[model samples]
Target chain A: MPAAATEAPTLDSLRRLTRAFRVEILRMIEAAGSGHPGGSLSAIDFLTVLYFRDYLNVDPKNPSDPNRDRFILSKGHCVPALYCVLAHKGFLPVEELRTLRKFGSRLQGHPDRRRLPLIEANTGSLGQGLSIALGLALSAKLDRAPWQVFCMTGDGEIQEGQIWEAAMAAPKFKLGNLTWIVDYNQVQQEGLTKDQMDLAPLKDKLAAFNWHTQEIDGHDLDAIDRALAAARKVTDRPKAIILRTIKGKGVSFMELQTAWHGKAPNKEQADKAVAEIEGGRR
Target chain B: MASATTGATRDAFGEKLAELGAAEPRLVVLDADLGGSTRTTAFMKKFPERRFELGIAEQNMIGAAAGLALGGKIPVATSFACFLTGRLETIRVCVAYNRTNVKLVGTHAGIGIGDDGPSQMALEDVAAMRALPGMTVLQPADRAETRQAVEWMVRHDGPVYLRLTRQNVPEIHEPGYRFEFGKLDPLWPKDPEAEPDLPSLAFAPPNGKPRRQAAILATGGVVSNALEAAKDLQSRGFLARVFNVHTLHPIDAEGVVRAARASQRLVTVEDHNLAGGLGSAVAEALAAAGQATPLVRLGLSDFAESGTTEELYAKYGLSASHIVEAALRNLA
Candidate 1:
């Protein structure tokens, strides 16, 4: 059985665990030969706090429990981080993380629910996860179920018009059971997100859309935990947490570097990054 | 002969869907600002709590429907065919790839939608939906067939794309008509059990002149036109058998091959683009079956102009006369 929030592990332990997960994220991506490492590293802390710290109501054994909270990685290119966290959460074997992106492996390059039934929906295509999350939240409301729906999207991914479409509908439907976390890393594949498409005043935009908005330093475990706790208290409208984060967060050489956005780290680079993440662990 | 009673397939869909909502509590409806036009207003009026008005955002609607399906609710997302399939990327990922139990209802299909013109008409929806693996594509010919297919869509698991007509299509199916998935319902001759005898493949019957025979495969609103075409062909002393092909993706291939063997030629008619709709499906079936039946595809060759349904059908070569001409063209 998973621990409740009251019996959750200390924030210090979560910090150490998340720092170690940075290595797992790199290891799998390095083994797979191609993945979006920058976004994965930027988003790992929130996923760890959500899964390991009892914010999400999923169990490894009863992953398909109807009443369990649904979490969807709408920015599915960053699934390496999700795979690592799911492994630690006992959803799958840790050894299977190495099989990610390989032919016939359950861990597809993106979140494919067909291949991994635990995934709430298939969501590699950008801007789609929020609407799907809206659907699940709507279903919960219709059934009067206690289940909640949470979706995570990259800062760059909100550029797709469908994101706004979902953003517009969730609030209109009064989907208080839903929460959307934006990993506002401010960087994308080609260049910085601002240079490509500016999402400045993102919190204001979401607030105007009627979402209960909050902005926090995404890498801080305490802030992530608190923001999620506060989001749960919101029962009249959808919650939007603009997680201001650094792309390629943990690795010094990769931080804020557009080159690390998609490329898999080489053997030397992977070793150096892993050493850096492990050294940062206190 | 076309029945005296005529009804829009969308009306049948909305009526059946609203009825299904009462019986199946798990059923939910989503509309992208086209509830009135798509006739989902009927379902929405009765089951307001169960209906979601997503407002002009088809991409979000498709994704939300997938999510609802994943959450164990049978979601029927309704929109104009052009607008609905316009968001194919979301449908490709959330619905098709995930195999979510979403019933996508695309109304206002083809030029039959009339003065709304090419923008509103779904000329490429069937092609887009058919290309996705495991996605069931259906285009019901009449009100009864639409009701039956709508019922089947809810009961069946996985994704289904139902193309419905905005214009009132003539009732071609009899009152006792039952919809069979992936099976062709022969409309002309009234009996499919008896093989349609028109002309021989090898030796002609020892009569005056061997009249050319054709098996007409038609889908959606054009089935009535094809039926009328068959009647006209009979009057002109040429025999043409018509098949109501409601199921477009997992089409009745064996039935198509059987028609190919029995008739001297095959003609497919639809209210969609000729490249990837009913024509392409029949062509693939015949090719795979190694049948040498010549086929003439009649559909929109280009984007249609704003006009009445009858004017567009007549001008765009989808009228009864056009179908009769297509069937007897090269055989003469």
Candidate 2:
């Protein structure tokens, strides 16, 4: 039997994981000279807690093992954070992180399942991951497997009509084994999410769709851990966690800035960001 | 009034699927509340535990199918081809992109779906399925072939898109004839030695002389039409060879190139868009082989019109006469 998840992820652990993820992601993007780092940095804590402490049922060596939990990164642009977490968990060599977005690298700008294992689906086009996760969850229910499927979506990507279609579907199907985490960083490539398209009353909207809903600070590992625990307790419906986070959480100048969504940090910007993350870790 | 002999392809698909469920325990069925229309009712009845009835949600149905494949289940998802293709982008991206072993049974493919009109006819499904990487596309010639195709798909690995017709077709292939994926079956002989020269008045080439002629490449219900045209053309002193191209993607490029080289005139017929169906695939193969034969492609031009299957076939110039005319034109 798998260990029961608890509110075990600590703030200190989260801070260290976040800094490590940020530094590695910067290095990856810098090596490749391209990739979306803002969203990856913003969603680091949630991904860290999920992979290292919650949801993921995986052994890095035996990734194709059937009983392991499935994780589908629907918002594929944030692959750097996902790659960092997967490497940290030993899914691949940590050295591969520096090859991000480079030609012939397994770590492409978007996630490709053929190149990586434990990646349930290849997702790049937004708003499709949840549906894939729902499929895996439904299969688990049918097979009577003890595996769960975790899907992470972006706030800007929620604007796609397909996401709502999946949102309404999970509850209707009573897929309690499915959990969806929305990175509500309030910024898109164009501008702030609210400025682009208001998705206010987000909690009620999910509730209306029949999802068991919880809202949390995305960067707060403890809050994310608790929300996931609460979600697991529900067996009647699918769960959705609305994770509130800054677009660029740790870096001062990049925080909440739309322009940083996909831009690689230059030498000076990289130095400043690295110093801040190191300072925070200290 | 529905004729006993004139059953929909969806009905044959369902009947064959029930047999598959009994044969393979891992075989599961999923429907988007269209069990009656898509003809998965028999499978649902026999294997209720293995069946999922997704109420009017094609997107969810696709997702659930992919999920089931991940759990070691061979799921056959049934829906109208139109709804299946238009609504289930996730299925194409997730299930197909991941190369999961799932079979998508798209019923009511092409304009053979009479009276329901353009919205129901899925002329673009072949194009959509072929566009996905690592996807195998199958369009069976008739009921027996549909069953054979389903069995072949179950044993085969990776994603498969099975295009089923809503119109009944005559059984052309004899019993025990093998159905191989990605290999074109030559229904008519091109070489004299390979042709069955029976003592009792064999169907020989016209003028009692073996001559180089065009190869008629087609699939689905149109194979019979193409065969009929080939017979008529043979009577008119033309040795038209007929090839039943069951698989669309990973097409029989070698066979097509060989036929194109020998014949130097290729005519493709199908009950779908002329742009991306069998004709387009054959054209692509010919181009790759640097063999540009005079090819006359016949299929639906654009949007389909509402009518009976026969009327629509004739209206869209996809009948035996149209094929015969195209073959003649290609020869000219």
Candidate 3:
């Protein structure tokens, strides 16, 4: 729609935006004194590309635009990342990012559609958001609207039986307008995903179920952009992009660690994580 | 075998939906591959452009319905009652919890879904729908009422759950019987011969206004049984007022309080669990209203056992005889 916002976003621009999203997310989680920063930081690049360069048809000021692309954060624990992107996109004032999880603030622990715009559904319970995304996609097809549905899930959350149920059904319905990106960080709330539950050959499993599958380095902004473009080209079946990523890619202390799954950083840890992200920005 | 009326609530739902689709361009239908059973095939045939078949997936059907509602479409999603609620966490979190105006039509509800056994019967649907904060739960008695319920649900400005039956029931209401959500319709007392119209000797209201007494609050298929029980109670000189409390959630609190105050004795009958159903809603209303009417709550005790609709109704004390016995005991 507006000629795809020309001047192809450069790797430097992508990294800078991702860094900004990570920093803002870390600051918000630190302000709340309790949030899942590891996943948020890990998912920043994927979310950044989707919102800025891919599927979403959003105008930050007009969050309720009837034909806007719909995004569902199935891994709702990583709401800090979404809040950062929404704030950066001007859906909410950038100053409001500090209000994350505060008393009487729109930013709850998970996305609440009633309280926030551009949040299509309420998703805190794992394994349920994909079903909703499928519904939204089906709705778009029925209404003959030209909008796509994007849902991001956690690798650990794949253990849920309902996720497979939804996965199995999406292809059967031929939902080409729907895309599911799994943040395959290989770490769960308890520990390593392999130690907890093995979801290996994830791509093969999705392909077997009739999904157009792609595995990419989640932190590679260019690879994410390419994969999203490739996803749009496949117009007959649903698409699944398995993003290989580190649990906390930018912050060295939290990287690939299970303890940061849902813990907030104290003042000391916050200062180090912020400095790490800000230094990466340069 | 008794020739059953060709009653599959899905048929009424589909026909009414197709009508709504023609009248309102925004009305769309979504099905989870049970189109034939859920009776959405008619709408699918007539409005193929507007019907979405999600192919045996209930979760996706619910999520897609919510998205459609967000995109300025009034989507009605249909599935068997068991799958509709068993796979209901999506509807709870995505649709109702988000306050999306999606209408969930669940067919094959209660023991009436005979022969298919317990897995197909949605005995606990009322509990599941009523648990949501602002959802409107409707259980219509017959085909005509089902049509009326669907129309009301479309006009209603929030999430709704319409419990549909698989068996045909005798038509009770006339063509233009006015229907209102959150209001009870009294089927009996059509004439002086009706039980609720009997002239009793005394026990009138102390303020000289006629005191409404001996009321039965029933919903869904139980309304028919309650009517039968009222007739028998009248023949035995026990006049009882029967109230069809159709809308389970946001229950008729004022009507319930008025009945409790007038009768000083109330009984609730439903084809569901005693907890969080019509009985529980009435009990909560009476409790909040601070009324001390003796209440007899009738429903399945816990888990249900396999049986025909009639056998299960008798076994679970949901038949006309059981209602009459409960009323008699309350009077005693």
Model 1 CA deviation exceeding 4 Å by range = A1-6, B192-199, B202-208
* Candidate 2 lDDT by residue in tens digits, A1-282: 232346535557666777888888877887777778889988888888777774577877788888888888889999899999889888888998888877788887888878765567788888877877887887788777788888999999999877886887788779999999999999999999998988988989999989999999888777987787788788889999999999888888888998898899877778888888888742
For model 3, the superposed segments whose C-alpha errors exceed 4 Å read A2-8, B1-10, B191-212, B330-332
TM for candidate 2 is: 0.92
Q: How far does residue B300 in candidate 2 sit from its true spot (Å)?
A: 2.2
Residue A277, model 3: lDDT of: 80
Better of 1 and 2 by DockQ: 1
Please tell me how candidate 3 rates in CAPRI terms: medium
Which lDDT values do the candidates have, in the order given?
A: 0.90, 0.82, 0.82
Using alpha carbons, what is the TM-score of model 3? 0.92
**How big is the positional error of residue B274 in model 1, measured in Å on the Cα after superposition?**
1.2
TM-score of 1: 0.97
Q: Can you write out model 1's per-residue Cα lDDT over A1-282, one digit (the tens) per residue?
A: 233356788888988998889999999999999998999999999998898788898889998888999998999999999999999999999999999899999999998877888888888888889989999999999999998899999999999999999999999999999999999998998999999999988999999999999999999988998898888889999999999999999998889999999999988999999998888842
lDDT by residue (B227-261, candidate 1, tens digit) is: 99999997877778899999998888999998888
- Residue A86: error of model 3 in Å? 1.8
Candidate 2 regions off by >4 Å? A1-10, B1-6, B87-92, B189-212, B262-264, B330-332
The superposed Cα distance between candidate 3 and the true structure at residue B238, in angstroms, equals: 1.8
lDDT (10s digit) by residue, model 3, range A200-239: 9899999999999999999998898889888888889999
Per-residue lDDT of candidate 3, residues B1-332 (tens digit): 01235465567877888787778887888888888888888877888878877777687678778777876778888898888877678888878778888989888888766678777878788888888887888988777778888999998888999998777666666667777877877666665353333324335543554433578998877777888888887677666788887777778898888777767468899887787788889989999999888899998766666777788888878999988888878365
Q: Which candidate is the best by DockQ?
A: 1
